[model samples]
Target: MVKVATTPLDRTRVARAALKLLNETGLEGLSLRAIAKELDVKAPALYWHFKDKQALLDEMATEMLRRMNEELAADEQPDTEWPDALSAALRGLRRHLLMYRDGAKVYSGTRFTDMSYAAPMEAHLRMLTGGGFTPGAAARAWLTGYSYTIGYVIEEQSMGPDPVKEEGGYDLAARAERLAAYPLAAAAGDEMFRDYDAGFEKGLAAVVAGIGATMRDAPGA
Candidate 1:
């Protein structure tokens, strides 16, 4: 058995250290032991603060959301339309997720460790409700946008974080060769794999439009 450290550690400090290590190692290689070494402590030292890896992940995701919220708040405008506000929020989420390797994976399913998420979420719902959507419609609209943001980031990170800068990650020529039997599918690879920024914006625009068309009703209007 390994020895435990007697020194006390702050949970946020441990989580922040883990976030930095995440960029170097990616999610598959991150472990409590690795984090302990990063902090120059024994593995058991982490257990006192985090019961297990999942608990630590919860905190990490929470911290990521907190930072994202801070950024969004800085850019927020009181008079902005609901669609623009929602788009900005999701765009902010994507930017933050792309900051770390497997950042989307780290954030996707983990539960937040605190109530910090409440304010931002409530604000979003209120924005939708104020825009003339029913409560149920507002909730659904927010979820649809949030889900798209998370899913898009997951795929974006899969090609290596910063697919734009990663060299030789997607071999369009080889992919086309393999799909020679299906010329259309082969030709589609470039549009699908390259220029993620434009693709994301186009897709998000469609999602927001659909939400507005389908959900913006006064019930009695």
Candidate 2:
């Protein structure tokens, strides 16, 4: 006979518990039963709110986006520079995602059609439009910036902590030395490794600059 688990679950409580578990166990270790246990509810109860694990995962992604939405509202509102404003908003989102384990993984491929995400998305579009970008160009710009932010953070998080294990660990240094044949890689070295926030800022700025340049060069926009 199979043993069954016991716990209470609802959408709100389960989602909250799921996020907590995600922070602790990461996406690979996440499970419906694990979340049910966190909420002190039966696995079946969790099923009532979420049809399956994928649904739960999707909801978790939404929760992360909602947190980003809140931060952008408070800190990344439309400013004098539309590109900078969009970049800042995306960087803010990356910061929030970094707060959790496998956060970018969870957010990746998740859809943001919910009304909650619409306001921010619309604001970004409006800001781009105000900057003289055509609708098609604005959409591309938004996607490009968003993808860059997400891709950067995903790679940043996957690299895990510094590869250096011991105080005198040569893992990083040796790796750097081995890249001598690759001029760009060797030149990057420690300079490429940066504080998460700084990386986000730098990347965001670069992407925004690229978009601005493109917009300026576009004909009849």
Candidate 3:
């Protein structure tokens, strides 16, 4: 019989198996052998598509981005207008990251030097520019908001609560009691620990409004 070519390994399948493993085992437990086992293949099979563990993780991150793209694609009105459309996109992106076990870590570290991520930024820039922001102002606005959102989500997800036991949960009231001298900080202590959605919205709105105000105040703007 003539030699035949077996089906080539698909990176997407490998990535999906890896992400599933991540959800079950956490990031520290991720490994090529684990993913291969998940796929019912040998570890070297993964190497055909990914050079090593890091490469596999990077592809998994890209898969996470693809998930964000799907959400953004589903939004019925992504290009409706300035802040409206851009906010929808950003919210979709953030929500997708929050869905995974360690979504923020995957997004921040992935060398997504790929067009999928870049195209979104370009679309956002167009939205900002259409909203009367100069090129420099638009760029700065996107960067500031992006940075703040990513940083906030990373911290939030990293410190996500464990439901198995409540013994180690954050003690906002106890801390407030200790910081009596710092009136303002103490007063807002409980507020800071409110639901993540509320906090994320508050911060995002503040940043967007501040950026708009600054752009309007600029000379000739």
Candidate 4:
């Protein structure tokens, strides 16, 4: 077989290529070899940059956050309330995670490869602290919001890239039939599967409110 010309490869370049391939092949089909092929290099060429697949995933997740941070920065406004800012940040995260096939699965539980996440995290924590939360409370509050966003995106992606546009994929009628023995669960299928956008907003608002009410009066607040 003839060799494909190799490109100069770096961690960022490889990770970005992997992210692009991810949309085509998805997380399950993604491999070092696949990324190498996408980058026009041998599989071993990737090891010079990433120690293993997990390391590559870490870089990809970090890149995803970097992009999300850019979007958040672009939309930021002066003197926004903490809850509003936090909500906006989480919404941005959800949108970012939904951009690729299995985007949330790729992002969830992966360690970041660099300090790119630190500055935005510091800003988020500062926002919470300024809103009368103790440092610990600030951390917890952020974790809660982040967890909700990640979990929600994962569920949304499980349905499809765009749940609202692909609503037929969910088979709500079948779901309702499956839950027919329990009348309330059958009825609840529409609320749970029909409109994710509205559901996410309502859920996010609840999470933000819960965090504020619980953390606002912590010891240092």
lDDT of each: 0.87, 0.74, 0.74, 0.86
lDDT of 4 by residue, 15-84 (tens): 8999999888778899999998988788987898888888989999999988988888888865888889
Per-residue CA lDDT of model 3 for 27-125, tens digit only, reads: 777889988898889988788999977787788888887777766766646548566665666677678777766667766756762567777678777
Each candidate's clash count:
0, 5, 0, 0
Q: Report the C-alpha displacement of residue 214, candidate 4, in angstroms.
A: 1.0
TM-score against truth, every candidate: 0.92, 0.81, 0.80, 0.90
**Residue 197 error for model 3, in Å?**
0.9
Q: How much is 11 displaced in model 1, in angstroms? A: 1.4
Give all candidate RMSDs, comma-separated. 4.0, 5.4, 4.0, 3.3
As for lDDT, the candidate ahead, 3 or 4, is 4
lDDT of 4: 0.86
68-159: candidate 2 lDDT, tens digit per residue = 77776877644557766776778687778777777888888876435777888798888888777888888999999889978887877676
Please give, for residues 1-221, the per-residue lDDT of candidate 1 as tens digits.
Answer: 99976645779889999999998888888999999998889999899999999999999999999998888888888778888988998899899998888888999899999998999999998888888888899999999998998898888778533533454457788999999999999999878777889989999999999999998886333
Give, for candidate 4, the lowest lDDT window spanning 10 residues: 160-169
Q: How many backbone clashes does candidate 4 have?
A: 0
Could you give me the TM-score of model 1 versus the true structure? 0.92
